[model samples]
Target: MSIKALVAHGSTNGSTAQIAERIGEVLREHGLDTEVRPAAQVGDVAPYDVVVIGGAVYAGRWHRDARRFARRNADQLSRKAVWLFSSGPLDASAAQRSIPPVAGARRAMAHLDAVEHRTFGGCLREGAKGRIARSLITSGRGGDFRDFDSVTAWAERIATQSLGARAEPERGDLRT
Candidate 1:
C-alpha cells in the first residue's frame, strides 16, 4: 500500500506551518499521499502510515497543543513511523546551532522510536520586536533562515524510505 503521511504542525507566527507545508509538498512530489494540517485540526492518525509532527518553540518550550498531541497519541504514534521537527531559531547562526526539544516534548518522545528530529531556522521581520530584542535576533540579516533545499532533501529521503510499498503485490514481487 502507498504510504499515507500527515504533516501536522502548531505555529504561532506561521513560520512552522510554512515548513510543514514545504515538507508535505516534497513528499507529494515523491509520490506519497501527504496531507498538511494544523495540529488542532487533526483528529485520528490511525489512517496514516507515517506521521510528521512539528511545532514552533517559544520561551524554551514547544507550543502547548503540539506537546499535547504528542503525548495524547503516543501509543498510536509509537506504532507508526514518526518524524519530528521544530522551527524557532531566527538567524542563520541560530539555525545551525544544536537546539534540542524542550522538556515536556522530550518526555513525550521518550518512546517514539522516531526516524529523526530536526530543527529548522525560523523567519522573523527585522523590526518586529523592540530595540534590544530586535538587535539580538535581527542584527545582520533577518528575512528567512529556513533552508528549503535541506527540507526538500529530507522529504525525499523519507519518501524513498517509506513510499516503496505496493498497493497490491505482483505475483512475484520481492518487495512484497
Candidate 2:
C-alpha cells in the first residue's frame, strides 16, 4: 500500500504554509500520497500513515493551532512515523540558525517518539506582520530567510524514512 502522509502547519503571513506545501509536494514527488492542510483544519490522523507537522515560531511559541494538533493527536502520532519541523530563525549560520522547537511542541512530541525535528530558516516580509513584527523588520532584524534547497533536502530525508528505504537514525535535528 502506498504511504499517505499529512503535512499540517500553522503559519501566519503564509510563509510556513508555503513551506508545508513544498514539503507535501516533495513527498508526493517521492511517491507518497500527501495532504497539506492548516493545522486547525485537521482534527484526525486515522487516514494517514505518517505525519509531518510544522509551525511558525513567534515570541518563542508555536502557533496555538499546531500545538493543539500535536496535543490532540499525540496518541495516534505515537504509533505513526512522524516528522516535526519549525520554520523560524533568520540567521544562515548553522550554529546560529539552529533553534530548538518550541516548548509546547517539544512537550507534545515527547510521547510520540517522532522520527525527527527540523528547524528551517523563515521568511519575514514587509507589511506582512503586525506592529511588533514590522518594527523588528524595520530595525533590520528580519527579511526573507527561508532556504528552499535545505527545505527540499530535509523533505527528501523524510521521504527516505517514510518510504522504508532506510532505517532512520535515532531522532536527530535538521538545522537548515
What lDDT would each prediction earn against the true structure?
Answer: 0.76, 0.81
Residue runs of model 2 more than 4 Å from their true location after superposition: 94-97, 165-176
Model 2 score (lDDT):
0.81
Top lDDT hit? 2
lDDT of 2 by residue, 1-176 (tens): 67788999999888899999999999999999899999999978988877999998888888787888888888888877788888777667423555677787787668778877888877787887678778778889887778888889999988877765323345332211
| Best prediction by TM-score | 2
TM-score between model 1 and native: 0.80
Candidate 1 off by > 4 Å:
94-98, 126-142, 164-176
lDDT of 1 at 144: 79
Residue 96 of model 1 has an lDDT of 62
RMSD (CA, Å), candidate 2 to true, equals 4.5
TM-score of each: 0.80, 0.88
**Weakest lDDT window of 10 consecutive positions for candidate 2:** 167-176
